[model samples]
Target: MTSSELWSRATAERYDAEESENSSAAAVEPALAFLAELAGDGRALEFAIGTGRVGVPLRARGVPVVGIELSEHMAAVLRRKADEETLPVVLGDMATTVVPGTFTLVYLVYNTIANLLTQDEQVQCFRNAARHLAPGGRFVVELGVPPLRVLPPGQVAVPFYVSDHHLGFDTFDLVEQTLVSHHFTRDGEDGRYRRGSCRQRYAWPAELDLMARIAGLELEERVADWHRSPFTGESTQHVSVWRGPSPARP
Candidate 1:
């Protein structure tokens, strides 16, 4: 299936319930604190604002929140959670969508950047974030580190999660720098599993730093997780913040 089709109506309907851990307080608190601190009293823009999962809570915290989503069905899911007046959404691709007003904070969370499957498109996404930010505005990203470690010597696929209700794993194309995530969920009493899959053009942390620099942003902080922990070799995911230049700088 294509990348755009990944967020189909059926998927949108089940997203929150199936990935409840992402919406949990424990998973979301660190991100909330960091973004809110950067935004202060200014507005924040969320790319791929699926179901308003993080946006809704951030808005409730008093930071004005707006969204750009490529899938109408996904936005429809978010609409059910919030009204247009409270949390307005624009139906367009985050990479190219131009919403009204500049933002103090523009963010893409939950590894949403991986949805753009090409390197050029990924660079465009960074440019897009810079375009929307006001001077000194910040762009935050939360993503998993590429799982090359799992694929030792000749291995191609490795399991990341195994459980009763869900089974998650990834297959890598080392030469192409791409990976496909395959997920299976057992939601019925009959014990049959439903499968969903998506592809991502993975990038290294240093490569992302270069992309940010190319897009007129500078790396401000790199944390191992949402809790602002120090990054290390063993960390699986990262929450990175990049900033546009200050008024006098560039």
Candidate 2:
């Protein structure tokens, strides 16, 4: 059985089929507004910009945006949406890929950072984000908080979502701070389930902040979502911003 993954051709082909936040203009508009405000006449860079779902819409808002993608298959899918004149994307990994020039804002959204699968690699991702940022520029990340609290004693798995078309859950290795998302979707005409998995290393909010600190970034703001709602204990995910040092101080 074939399953979709970050670097898989099948995943690239069906990446946008789901009704995710990227699928709706209502959800994307607020994110565009937030990013455009931070961009402020400077360019923005997106890490792991799979299929231009956000980049195309962000560019439509008049913000100049470039992207770096690890998978050429996924980048190819993005090319169908917009040409280089509208959105230029480079083929490279977010943890180490470098594009010439700095950006006023660099963002990794939709839990993409979790794809790194290790703490050291995740820190490298933060450093890379800082490397792309101009003085006083900000790095924004949309990530889910680990679902550890929901786990009862001796339970290593948690169901994150269930719907008529899909059932999604996560299995964790707490000691290693690692997790894998298991997704079963009924895309077949016969209604048979197709399984796909993505493994990631989950980090706490504070741990991510520390990674930012190591990368010479400071925590600026953290919200529940793109709406800028205050993050609370009940919030499962966060949209966080970390600012690089101002030029005068650097």
Candidate 3:
């Protein structure tokens, strides 16, 4: 399916409540704190800010947060959490969306960059971020390393989780890096289920650095986690910092 169709279906489905709770904004407090420090009293933009998972809490900390999301359904979920006037969310694709005003920081986290499969689209995303950034602004990206090369054939990895009535299902995909998870609950007489799925491409840290260079940005820092730990070969995830060219210098 096309990316648009995939996203539409994924967002329309009712995601497992337990999964959402477990992966709540509070869970990524460390990352949020790093972002807050990076912004340093400047406005921030979150790409693909689904359900306001990061934006909501970032705003609560008195940081002006704006979001660009492609899925209207997910955006609706975010809106329900906060007043429209308080958090401004633009419904559009992160790869090509154009929003008014410049921001000191722009971030796309949790492997969201891999959602754009092609190299062209990924480079476009960086350019888009550069376009909206103020002088010397930063674009932060967080993603996991690809495990395809190491995983044994026919072996699947944990992709998603859902729980209902203390019973849950975690879907795994061996052939494709995708997942379709369902969680059902029985309430005495009747039972209901919530289902959702997501498919993403994995990326390497080095490749992303080249993409950033092509977008007229420079990699300033690479850390293994939110605490700024030095990145190592064993690290499975990364938080990369890219700096846009200053308007005065360029």
Off by over 4 Å in 2: 1-6, 19-21
Candidates 2 and 3 compared: the better one by TM-score is: 2
lDDT of 3: 0.76
Provide the lowest-lDDT 10-residue window in model 3.
159-168
Would you list the C-alpha lDDT of every candidate in the order shown?
A: 0.89, 0.89, 0.76
TM-score leader: 1
Q: Using Cα atoms with residue i matched to residue i, what is each candidate's TM-score against the true structure? A: 0.96, 0.95, 0.80
Task: Report the C-alpha lDDT of model 3 over 1-250, residue by residue, as the tens digit.
Answer: 2253235545444442534753565667888899998888899999988777788888888889999888888888778888777889998888898888999999998778877756677888999999888889999999876645565666555433334453444344544544333444444546654343445555578888998998889999999988899888888789999998877843
As a whole number from 0 to 100, the lDDT of residue 142 in candidate 2 is: 94
Q: Residue 239, candidate 3: how far off, in angstroms?
A: 0.9
Which residue pairs come into collision in candidate 3? none
lDDT of candidate 1 over 1-250, digit per residue (tens): 2244347899889999987987898888778888999998899999989899899999989999999998888899999888999999998877777899999999999888888887887888899999999999999999899878767798999898999999999999989888889999997799999998988888888988999999999999999987889999999999899999988843
* lDDT score at residue 169, model 3, on the 0-100 scale: 40
In model 1, what are the clashing residue pairs, if there are any? Answer: none
Count the clashes in each prediction.
Answer: 0, 0, 0
